[model samples]
Target: MRRLAAGVLSLAVAGILLAGCSPAPASDDSPLSAASPAPSRSTVSAGDPDLPAMPPTPAPSAVVDDAAADDAGERLRALVGDAGRPAEVALLGDSFAAGEGAGSYQPVRGVADSLCHRSADALLADAAGTPPSPPGTAILHNLACSRARMSSVTAAQAVEGHGPEGVPAQLEQLAGIRPDLVLLSIGGNDLGFAGLLQACVVDTEPCGQDPALRETTRQQLLQLQAPLTDVYRTLGAATPAPVLVLPYPRLFDAGAEDCGRLSSTELAFGLEITDALNSTIERSVQAANLPNVRYVNALEDSFAGRGACSPDPLVNTARFGPLLNAATSVPASQEVLHPTQEGYRVLTRDLLRWLEENPM
Candidate 1:
C-alpha cells in the first residue's frame, strides 16, 4: 500500500515537471523587468505567523541519540583517516548552510521570536556530529542564518524579530575561537536569489526575458566582488584556519525544458545568474590571493543531469505549488533554489573528498 502511494506521488511530481516545460505565453511587461531596483534583502516579515517555528535551543541535558552519534563519529574517523584528533570546524553563511529548506531548524538561544533558521540537519551539523571531538573542544560553531548577506558578516546587524536590538556581527562569533577549518556558503542572498525566483515564477509575466532587468541584476551581482574579496581577506587574517567558500550550485540543467514553476526562460536566466555569481566569487578569491582561502567548486558537475527539471534534483522543487499559491505562506519552505537534505549530502560527499585530497 505504501509503495502504491509513493508511486502515485512520483507520478504527480513528474506530471508537474512535464507541464512546466510547455512554452509560456509572453506578456508585454514583467514585474521583474520594472525599472525600479530590486530590494537589497528579503522582504518576508520575520514575525510572520506562517513561518515555520524553530525548536527552542536544546539544553545540554537534551542529549543526542547515542547510536547516531556513534555513526557520525565513524564517518568522521573515516574521512580524517588516522588523524586521531578531529579538526575543529565552524560553519558560516546563509540559508544553505543553515539548512533552511532541508527541514528542522534549531531554535535561537534565549530569543523566542528569533528565526535565524539554524538546523541540526544542516551539512555542517552532520559533519560536526560525524567527528568525535576531544573532551572540552567545540567541534562546530554554526552561525549561518536565514537571509544572511555579506553585510551580515561585516556589520553588526540585527535579525528581524530575533531581538529588540541588533545582534552582533556574524564574524564576531569567530572572534576568540580559532577552528581548523571554516566552511562558508554565502552571497546568494546578496544577489537577491529569493526575490529573483519570486519575480520570475509568481509574476504573470516572465521577468527573466527582460534585457534591462537582467543587466541591472548582473551589475548588482558584479558589484559584490569587492565585498566578497574583503570577507575572504578578513577571515584569512583573523584566523589561521583555512576558509572554504562554497559557491551556489547551478539549480537547472542547461537545455532542460523546465522544472515545476520555473519556465525554460527562467531556467536559462537563473543559470546565467548562478554562473555569474560563482564566477564573481572565484574572481574575488583569486584577487585576494590569500593562502588560507580557497574556493570549492562543489557545484560544477555535481548536480549535472539532476537539476530541478531532472527526475532527481538536488534542489527543492517540491515546494513550487505551495510557493505559487497565495494561500500557503509556509515559512522557510519558500527556500526556493536551496538544496535538499540529499543535495547537502552530495555536497558533503564532495567536500569530504576535497578535504581528503587537500590535507592541511
Candidate 2:
C-alpha cells in the first residue's frame, strides 16, 4: 500500500512507517486521521469488532494444502533466524503496509510495537499476536511514503537503493544482507490509475461508459506491465527468498448508489475502472512469471462482489458510522485507495496460509 500521509502528516506518522527502514519525508499535507494516522500495537485489537471476519481460515480452503503449509512454515523458520529467533524481513511497498488509519503501535509479529510503517509487521503481529524481538530479531523496514511511486523505492535513503530509481543500488544492498524474504506491494502508482479513474468520474459521462475512457484505462494498464516486469526481474535476481507482490485491493464502494449523493452513473464508472484494473493485474502477472515472484490475488478475494460500489455491499453504504458514504468514506486511507486494517487482516490471514503452503 502507498503511504497515506504527505507533508506534516507524514512527519508525525513517519515514526510509524514500518520498522527498520526510514526515508526522508515528502512534502505533502499532513495525513488526515482518516489515514489511521499512526498505529501502534494496542490499536490492532482496539479496532471495530463489527468489521467482517477475514475469509475462513486457510486450513479448510481447497486452494491450499499440507505441502504449501509446510513450505510456508519453512520459510518463516528461515526468516526468523537460528532457533526461530526473530530475524530480518524487509517490507517494501506504499502506505498500504503502514496500517494507516489503524492508530499507533502498529503491531507485527517478531517486531516491537511502536510507529513503524510496515504492513508485514502488522500482518506478522496480527497473525502471531505479538511483535517479534531480538535473538528474536526485528529488522522490519517500511520505505513507503504517501506520494511514493514505484520510483520512490529506488530513491530514499531508508529504501534509497530499493526505490524505483535505486533498483541497482537495492540489488547491491540485498546481495550483502541476502534477506530471508521481501514483501512487494507496488504498481498502483505506475499507472496513476486511481487519479485517472477519479478524473473520469468528475469530468465525463459516468453512465455512457465512453470508449475513450475505457481505452485510457486499458492503455495505462498496458504501460504498467513493463515497469512491473522490471521490478520483478530486479527482485528475482537480487533476493533468494520468495518475493510476494500483494495485489491491489478492489476499488469502488459498490453500494455507493445507496448514498443518493453518488449517482448510479458514478457508481457504474467506479466499478468499470475497478474491473479494468484487476484485469490488467491478472494478465500482467500471468505474462511476467518472474522466478521467485508470486502475485497474491488479495483484491479478487476481498472486494469481489462485496466491493465498494459493488453490485451488493456487505454493509449499507448509505448509513453513517462504519459504513457511511461508500462513495467517500471507504477509501481505506485518504487519497490512497487500499484496504482498511479490516482489509489488511484479510491479507494477513492469506499470507499466513500462503506462507504455510510455501515455506522456504
RMSD of each: 12.6, 12.7
Name the lDDT of candidate 1: 0.59
Cα deviation of 176, candidate 2, in Å: 7.3
Q: What digit string (tens of lDDT, one per residue) describes model 2 on residues 280-341? A: 45455555677677766543455444444443442123222222222232222232333444
Ten residues in sequence with the least summed lDDT for candidate 1: 39-48
Off by over 4 Å in 1: 1-84, 130-138, 318-320, 324-327
Model 1 TM-score, 2 decimals:
0.73
For this target, which candidate reaches the highest TM-score against the unseen true structure?
1
Instruction: Output the worst ten-in-a-row residue range by lDDT, candidate 2.
Output: 29-38
Question: For model 1, how does the per-residue alpha-carbon lDDT over 1-360 read when each residue is reduced to its tens digit?
Answer: 755443443333321221111111232221222233222112211112253322221111112343544355345445442355655677887776777657666666566534566766676555565235564333666777776777778676566665665656778877866677788877776666655555565554666766665656656655677888998898788888778888776667667786655677777666656665676777788878999899885444456566767777777663445334412333433444566766666666656656667765
- Whole-model lDDT values for every prediction: 0.59, 0.43
Q: Count the backbone clashes (under 3 Å) in each candidate.
A: 1, 71
All candidates' TM-scores? 0.73, 0.58
| TM-score attained by model 2 | 0.58
